[model samples]
Target: MAPQGVAIIGGGIFVKEEHLPAVLACPQLSLKAIWSRSIKSAQETAKLIPGDASTSVDLYSSDSGEGKSFDDVLKRPDITGLIMALPITEQPAYIEKALAAGKHVLAEKPIAKDVETAKQLIAKAQKIAAETKATLSIAENFRFVQGYSYGAEQVKQLGKVTGFVVRISWSMQTDNKYLNTAWRAKPEYQGGMLLDAGVHFTSALRKLLGPENAVDSVIAQTSLIQSYLPPVDSINAILKTKSNVVGSFIFSVGTTLSAFDFLIACENGSVQAEGSRVVTTRGAGQNATKEEKTFEKSNGVKEEVSAWAESMASGTPNPQQAPEMALADLELLEGMLTSGDKDGARQKLELQHHV
Candidate 1:
């Protein structure tokens, strides 16, 4: 099959560092164009695409007088797909437009600012896709990470999962490039850094626990530890799964401490994951049998892009990071914040489906 021509819609740090490289690396995908708010930023991002200058990637912007506008790019018949890395609030409209143009879409996590908008966008996309036969996928890269995949497999060996715990923390200083973005610094989007970063962990948690266990309810406490980001910066939540499994999650983007840990306890054994290493233990303390495995480190961008391109070519949606799955991640994050605001009151997950 011919490589699917994909245009990237956002020219930010992640686009340059992750998406661009991933697009370049995916044999099924061809780097076609880049669009940003400004032509200069789009040009700068185009420089990062590896290729001869004679065959340079096209650049477009909302304000660019020389290049094609956003609508023009969407109208182009050659571009088969779009990879969006825009803000959470700005994604739904573009996604709708792209789907209407009959282009497959792979958007970044947190489908929309809220569940209602997400549902509307998804329904519209699905309608267009059914009529036009275009595909829609979310770029929840955590689901594609090799280490997380291995850890999830190990979790399955532990028999019926009883409970789990997830801890993710990192300090976002003023100098951080991601935080330096005006929208991220003073996010008009819901959940600020928490929602922006929280979706990844929520996606991971959902994948690790498997589809049988859905986060039925959540009780959470949130605090604004950092003055730079508004609303909330830290979250401590307890999740109850539909199958009666319990889980705890702690997410902080302002704390001085740095950690990433996920442990799953089951009737037969336990699986503990810290970064790329997953350790599985069974039996009592004295007779405990432990096995440790470390996977190659990856941000999973390449895998995700490749999968998206494959799906676009084959006319089958990648089941791993479906739109509804991403919506479930958003639901969990939103539920946590909602519960937190009510003094850790329990918020039920009202979504009808689970991935």
Candidate 2:
């Protein structure tokens, strides 16, 4: 099949750095257009596109006085899909518009600002998708990372899961590019940085635990350590999966501490992942054997984009990038923040979807 003609709909930091590179690198996709809220930003981002794509790609801006606009691009016959990474609160409307225009979409997560908004958007999008025969895939690139995928398979082979622990700590400095974004710095949304960054860890952990062992409940305590990070930036939670496997999740983006690890212990053995490396140990004591695998340059952004292009080409959505999965990730993060707000009151997850 000919490459699917698609457009990059946002001109923000992530769109310029990650999404643009990944979309340009995907052979199954053709860069037909680039749109930003401003024409100047759109043109600047287009410069990053090399060779033929730089000339072939059209530019549209929402603020333009001419006919060149996002809606105009959507009306074009050549563009059949959209890959977008907009501010969390500004995404749902764009998603609805794309689906209504009968274009497939690959949108960045946490799906929406919260579960209720996500549910409403998803329900409407699903109906439109069914009628238009188009697809909507929420991008949670952590689901495609090498270490997490390897660890997940190891979990299946390691027998009954006993428990797990996830530790993530890093300071989002004032100079941090992501933190510099206005939406992130002020964050009108709930859980602030906790909601924005927490979904990534949640997706990875859920990927390792698999569907049958999805997180069912959480009791957490959250706090804002740095004054600039807004509502909250740290969370410590105890989680229980549907299979009775218990685990602890601790994430803090406002601290000076810089450590990250996800460990799953099973009856026969255990799997541990730190960044791009995954280690598995089997057997006991002197007989215990350990093997470690390291992945380089495997952030999964390109892989996830390529998967979305393939799914769009084949007219089927990849379950790994399903909206429901994104919803589950958001639910877990929201549950943690909700429980934290209630002084560690337990919160149950009812909208979680498994794959």
Candidate 3:
């Protein structure tokens, strides 16, 4: 099928840092245009899109101020969906506009800084989608990454999966440019590193395992590691899914190593994927053996963009009922944090729209 014509609606670190590279690299999706308030960003986005005058994508300004902006791009005949990677707070208005314009959408995580906004956006997106029949996807790219994909696939292959475990710990150097302490450290934009990273883990777990999962009423602790940015440093939690499965989450911005891996233990077998490959151990006791499932590094951004294209053309979603990933993950983060509060209470998460 032909690739969907996509327009990205943000500039700055996320667009330049992650989205730009991915969009440039993706084969199934074409960077038709970009909307950043800055002309410099507009030029940068235009340069990255793959085309000449015949194929050039119109770059738009995301600023929506006194200057030219994406508001004009949304009215164009060629654009279909808007890929949003804007700050957590600045998302809802754009999402609503995109949906109203009969355009599809794919947004970054923590759809909104808070759940109420998430609900509003999701409900609005759904309403527009039902009426307009367009696609609305979340840019939850971590799920497309090989390591997480393999780990989740193993859980499916192994019957009667009982539990899931994941550890996403990375000690980002203070000077890590990607993680600007100024923007990310600020709670409103970053929502802490977990909101940024941990959401990926929770989204992965729910999709790979089951959203019916919750931290057992019995055991689980949510521990905050640092305060670099309000609620952006780190957190750890042990959870149990309704399937009677137990999963542990160890995520920290203060990790000594750049460790981000998920291990799922099942009744028949267990799988572990680190850095690149997903390995499985079969049988029980010392007799058990280990085998790994390896796949080429996924062109995740490309695949994700392509998926959005196909969904728009096909009018069907792959992981049906999977709520907007970024929004749901943020809700899960909220629940985890609230449960992790000093009272030591059980948190309820309902994000598993489809298991």
lDDT over C-alpha atoms for residue 139 of model 1 = 95
C-alpha RMSD for every candidate: 1.5, 1.2, 3.1
After aligning candidate 3 to the native by TM-score, how far in Å is the CA of 76 from where it should be? 0.9
lDDT of 3 by residue, 1-355 (tens): 6666778887766676667676666666666777876667777766654456325756566453543576787777677778887766777788888878888888776667777778887888788878877666777766677676667667777777777667777776667775673557565643466676667677766666644443333233454455554554666666766676766777777667577677778888887876368788888899998997777776366567656666677778756324555656676667766766644476776654544
Q: Write one digit per residue (lDDT tens) for candidate 1, span 247-335.
A: 89999998998989898898878888775788889864788899988878887888898888888777788888688888888999999
C-alpha lDDT of all candidate models, in order: 0.85, 0.90, 0.67
lDDT of 2 by residue, 1-355 (tens): 7888999999988888899999888889889999999899899999988786599899999888677998998998999899988899999999999999999999998899999999999899989977987788999999889899888998899898899999999989889888888888889899888888889999999888888788889999999999988798899999998889899999999999987999999989999987599999996688899999999857789999999988887777898998999998999999999998999999999966565
Clashing pairs in 2: none
User: What's each prediction's clash count?
Assistant: 0, 0, 10
* Model 3 worst lDDT window (10 residues): 211-220
Reference-based TM-score of each model: 0.96, 0.97, 0.86
Q: State in Å the error of residue 163, model 1.
A: 1.8
Ranking by lDDT: 2, 1, 3
Ranking 1 against 3 by TM-score, winner: 1
Worst 10 residues of 2 by lDDT: 346-355
Top-TM-score candidate index: 2
